[model samples]
Target: MGLPKRDQQYHTYADYLGWPESVRYELLDGVAFMMAGSDLAHQDIVGEVFAQLRNALQGKPCRPFVAPFDVRLPKPRQSDEQTDTVVQPDVMVVCDPAKIDRRGIRGAPDLIVEVLSPSTAGHDQVLKRRAYERAGVQEFWLVHPTDRVVTIYTLGQDGYGKPEIQELVGTTPVGVLENVEITWDELVARLPKIEY
Candidate 1:
């Protein structure tokens, strides 16, 4: 379902920019894929984690953001017209002020967190994972709310290396950002228990 393109044709940032704001989509390799609405659990998890990051990043250089914010990944030497890939990470932390353009992030963020769901497991784990790696996103975290676990990938000279998996509880370090971690005990308690 995640691979559902609006139409079977290549699209670009220029085309994406012209679309109505009411409807949201992301361009991957010039392919326009519709973004689905977040369910209650997904929104709750993203909200809580973002809240945590916001508090932790206070007075810090890095800033946290939730989705619907564009992250344009332009291939090397490609201009805006030639650039294709653009995505909205669920939660992102941008440390560079220059990347924080008026429209959205012009480059990769320091850290990107994606809350996974049944509808998006494959796409996030596979498609978006590769995209983030290629774009040099320093760190990528996939928060599996259902399984209560997190999988992190840190970009390296060879791109991303092996993933580091951690339980979505207690004090788990944000590897890319020093002295920052997610203490999930309180956050977990706040989340409503629901059967998927």
Candidate 2:
């Protein structure tokens, strides 16, 4: 069953915590958007990215996480209730240990990776993109599973500059982490071809 339409209502992290655990949501500017389950190919891609990051970042202070992880994005000086935005990117890395807690991340992560799904592509590219920019996330990557491409956005002095898009080939370097690289050749061998 679909969730009730609450587009006209505003929500927050406190409200989010009280909701039934069975349901999942991503809040954008206090508006609740229920999340959908990812498909096989999507999961395959996500798994590969996370696995690569895990091995590459070993012995490093930064840690990587997969989705279903709550990332609370509060505005400046906002408390739990006052904070209205949260999301679960497919893969993320938190270099600053202070930002992580038992619940999840309390602040912006140094890097985030979102594998684009057809239904939520626009939300990831536009709404969440702007939110990440505002939260001061240093880097964001949009991975298109079916399209076999990745678009990277690095936050600069004036917000995110023009994105750099790359075809899924060769090795893609992690901008925020030094000596860490994602091997596309191996990922391609494992990823199933997903149609757009």
Query: Judged by TM-score, which candidate is best?
Result: 1
Q: What stretches of model 2 exceed 4 Å from their correct place?
A: 1-7, 190-196
TM-score between candidate 1 and the true structure? 0.95
- lDDT string for model 1 (148-188, tens) is 88999999899888998988779888888888888888766
Clashing residue pairs in all predictions, respectively, total 0, 0
Alpha-carbon TM-score of each model against the true structure: 0.95, 0.93
**lDDT, candidate 2, 88-158, per-residue tens:** 88899998898898899988999999888878788889989999999999999999877789999999999
- Candidate 1 Cα lDDT to native: 0.87
Q: In model 1, what is the error at residue 49, expressed in angstroms?
A: 1.2
Give residue 181's lDDT in candidate 2 (0 to 100). 79
- The lDDT for every candidate, in the order shown, is 0.87, 0.87
Lowest lDDT block of 10, candidate 2: 1-10
